[model samples]
Target: MNKKEDSPSSLDLIWGVSEIAKMIGRTERQTYHMIQSGNLPMVKQVGERYVASRSKLIAFFIEDAA
Candidate 1:
């Protein structure tokens, strides 16, 4: 299989709750709570899972920091 076909153009384009949690050094459960509280922006839905846009998430933190 071609590597490009197997993975995304950019790994950060879409991140699952576990990936986001790992990036922020938080647990998956905590990340879910943040999503439920509307603190974090949720991305497109793929089936039953919620993924987040990397750029949007970064922007969210940047705006939050301001």
Candidate 2:
């Protein structure tokens, strides 16, 4: 087995705004705007991509819900 495969890259743990939006029940447009404007937590632009970590977003929203 490959070491890189065994330990996933940070990029592998994140999802684009569209996917993240679906997971959080928000519209893709709104999610994209929010993330782009830095209104959402745990989202950032890496090179040409906007991405957020699945676990971090889950924790953030859960804490927010509480």
Candidate 3:
């Protein structure tokens, strides 16, 4: 397998909204609004894209569920 397959799917680093949205099953626009409206924590807009930590996204949901 390649490097990406060898490791986890970058779930612990900062990435743009498009990629982040794919991970969380949300549209890019929805993710943008989520960040803008402060619904999802630890997310922010940087230039034309919103950025967030994938691990934090996972943690937020897990925390919310509990």
Candidate 4:
């Protein structure tokens, strides 16, 4: 087995719309609007819900800050 395989990855952790909103201090409704407006990237969709990875969201903030 590889050492990498033994460790958990933050990138593998997924977050839903509400979690993300709480992280960024926004309301769920506003988060949804951000997704629809192309401000935030949606990594996956399940029925009516949106999902995003923590790493991707951090990258978004980094890029936006630059």
Clashing pairs in 2: none
Residue-by-residue lDDT tens digits, candidate 3, 1-66:
577745664436666887888978899899888887888878866797667778888889889889
Candidate 3: TM-score? Answer: 0.69
Clashing residue pairs, candidate 4?
none
Which is superior by lDDT, 1 or 3? Answer: 3
Per-model RMSD to reference: 3.0, 2.3, 4.0, 3.8
Q: Which candidate is the best by TM-score?
A: 2
Which residue runs of candidate 1 sit more than 4 Å off their true CA positions? 1-12
Off by over 4 Å in 3: 1-11
Off by over 4 Å in 2: 8-12
User: Top lDDT: which candidate number?
Assistant: 3
User: Which ranges of candidate 4 are over 4 A from the true structure?
Assistant: 1-11
Task: Give all candidates' CA lDDT scores.
Answer: 0.74, 0.76, 0.79, 0.75
Per-candidate TM equals 0.67, 0.73, 0.69, 0.68
CA lDDT for candidate 4: 0.75
Q: How do the candidates rank by TM-score, highest first?
A: 2, 3, 4, 1
lDDT of 2 by residue, 1-66 (tens): 767766755544666677878877899899888786876867877787777777778888888889
Inter-residue clash pairs, candidate 3: none
